[model samples]
Target: MISSFSNNVYKMHQRTQIMRTTTFIKRRFSSAHITLKDSNYITREFEEISIPVPWGHLKGKWYGTRNVRPILGLHGWQDNAGSYDTLAPLLPNHLGFLSMDLPGHGHSSWLPLGISYHSIDYVSLLLRVMDYFQWDKISMICHSMSSINGFVFSALFPEKVDMMVGLDVLKPLARSSEKIVDNYKNCMNNIILHENRIISSEPPSYDWDELVDRLYYGSKKSVEREACKFLLKRAIRPSKDYPQKYYFARDSRLKTTYFYSFSKEVPIEMARYINCPYVFIKALQAPYYESRQHFDKTLDIMKQNPHFEYYEVEGTHHVHLNDPIKVAPIINSFIHKWRPS
Candidate 1:
């Protein structure tokens, strides 16, 4: 918000935690042991998985032993599951890690036409995933857009969440009524335009260097140049029309997401409902997207929870992926205290 394929060999493209007590429910999960990045623990394995939904299916990457209830990982808007590539391995052994591309974001199928993507829809989608796994209580690791989803989900159903860790974002952003109205209008217009383009046009394809450049600069250089490869793994597909060029496979409609901006009072009120063991890491350089007062107010309310931990780290919005070593220790601390394996 994030793969292994190199630009030199572009042919191959590829591809959480929790407090819910010691309930060990195992599914028929396929397990593989592969060495992850510079992980602090011994080798942790990963496998590619596809979870069925009514429309189509959602694809994901599962790391470590799948027999244990894994901490579900959610990436930022536009990013795929590979966003956790570096950070997953750094987690505690036996804790397990699972991350999936939200529909229209990675290998997951896009919503059928006529359904516009809303940030709040993810709350229901999270429920679908939980039912799929038949999980009783869940732990989460969310970044950016998904982080806000976690905030809303936790507020809506506080008892279902055992623990949560949000990176760089905490709630649905606040905006003036006029600004929200303008954005809503723009989103409606853009949805129709994006739909027409998708039905009638082929997306522009880019060379490998250009893809990396776009990802690096497009995120305002938040994702390091080298770190760009992890996201590119599941992001690009070799173009059928043009050799040596690739196109982004995700649904373009995600770019114009219709976030239902709430007033600051709503999120502050929502914060009071989150009683789970929570950790929020704020990247100092990231934009607030609104007034700092709005963020501070919500945070102050969340701080009232004794189990809630907050840290301000020096990095960009994608700090979890860019410099995971700095982020992992904070997470590890929360895990050992709340839901140790």
Candidate 2:
């Protein structure tokens, strides 16, 4: 029997799933949409670094310039490096950015054949990304699900990051046993009932205009059409038969049932234990999954965390990447304050 709250949650979840799938199927590819300019100040370079996973090589790009200060940018789930393309321009000059597509998303190869994408695996991947760049310590800016990983990384390896900024999500700690069971049941229900299929038997070709519409109006709200095109290019690939088809390389099984309950005693304390300066930019309009009581308790842990500070932004989940004006300065200010003289 579905409780009223569970029923409401499932309805919202279904709507989101449908919209995402429709957007994924209809997304297009166009070179005219690539917005990164060949300017004097910004020098972009694409490079391939072996992630040393059992699967194979994972390609990443080093954006900005070689000599500039280094900052690592991690994108959200099912999103790629281009998530930063628009926001990167708004950042303060003189700092280099490294944006990498996580293993199962974007240009990077999958994790072998049978290996499923798990939340825990990202910790090791971040360390590998840091090691590949030869940066013993650096600053980080992350969005959505990636933000959770960033928080965990910061808590576990506080010394590695000089300062860290997380957008729209804090690292969620353990939940009550009932809540945990409910979440697990939902996941299992989804995996069993939902068939993970994006493209149709004959996928339709999409022009630039149609692609932008699906992205801007469909998933993201009030995003400029032109900016939407730029994101589409990174999100999609060219189809030979049709106009151009966009198919996400991210694993569909990521949506399947899974358990992520952690030890509340230690990890929440770990966030409190983070040694470096930390900033959390939360989305004001976002929904808190757990109840207000539990949510308040969790944030109380954050408030007590000495090295942490948080700011609320004016958007939905993907606040930072979607809106440059609100997020860019907050990131810049945090980094500027922490950067060495």
Candidate 3:
């Protein structure tokens, strides 16, 4: 009887060990399957698309399906579509994003030989993009200069903008009448110089590390080193002469951007016209180029609108790129609330 009992106990122990091994194997396979599925899902999310213009085609990355209208993303001055690279992935996948390179930026065509880059010109670009996509109304996610553009656009065509999310900017810098006249003269001279450069000069090429360093410091170190790869996606191209070297693909003439800025009164008046859902996020560390009073005045006007919302986050001008996690949640929440089902 004792021998039979010992033998049964051994068999039970063996069965328990076998069950433990099987459970471990199942868990391992389940984890691997999840990782593979996520990788595949990411790969299938974004589609490359282009819109043809009079000069050339505007390149874009469409994140999500074409069946639904997308939230239009516009980058800051001199930045490209890749500006959204980090932030886009963090947002809800149910909504679509159409991040495009503005004229003279990224793979998009440059303006004609003598045509200068101006704030108003971007508004026209916005209109052209809408027309090309056959979108009766637009929803925008914009940063810096592009944010200002969205402000102008929404103010001018209140009914056309369904909703807008602006990051790190509220309005264009206001200047005295004297400064405006001076700026016009400076703008003309710079435009002429940039035009000549565009015709006669090729952008300087650099090694990969050097290119990343330049971009990092060029943004005053707002962009982190590791994050440089995101901007480099659309910003660099192989040099024609040196296979190993790369040049900035964006038009160098963009450096001489002209701003047909509005006075404080103008933006205030414009703010009155904006009645749609709007969100403005100010980076705490970013310089308020316009006076605090001016910023406050604009905010007050926007506050009167029932749908307007304002937020502040801790970061630099390129906060959306450097620390997307901090910005993405607020943006995603706003979009999720206002975006159409």
Candidate with top lDDT is 1
The C-alpha lDDT values of all candidates are: 0.81, 0.61, 0.77
Q: Per-residue CA lDDT of candidate 1, range 161-226, in tens? A: 988999999788888889888989999889988899999867899987899899999999989776
**Candidate 1 lDDT trough over 10 residues, lowest sum:** 18-27
Off by over 4 Å in 2: 1-53, 173-226, 240-243, 257-259, 263-267
Q: Determine which window of 10 residues in candidate 3 has minimal summed lDDT.
A: 13-22
Model 1 gets an lDDT of 0.81
Instruction: Give the range where candidate 2 is weakest over 10 consecutive residues by summed lDDT.
Output: 13-22
Q: How do the residues 250-298 of candidate 3 rate in per-residue lDDT, one tens digit apiece?
A: 8777877778656657888888899989999888888988779888988
The residue pairs in collision within model 3 are: none
TM-score of 3: 0.85
Q: Which candidate comes out best when scored by TM-score?
A: 1
Candidate 2 lDDT tens digits, 1-341: 11232223111100011111101111221111122123122223434344555577676667656685468888877677767766666566677777777876767776654445568787778777667667788688888777888888888888888888887767754677787788767766665333434323323445555656666766556345434543454555555666444443355555552535664554567667676888887777776544555455656777775666777655666555444546666677777888743
* Candidate 3 wrongly placed segments (more than 4 Å): 1-44
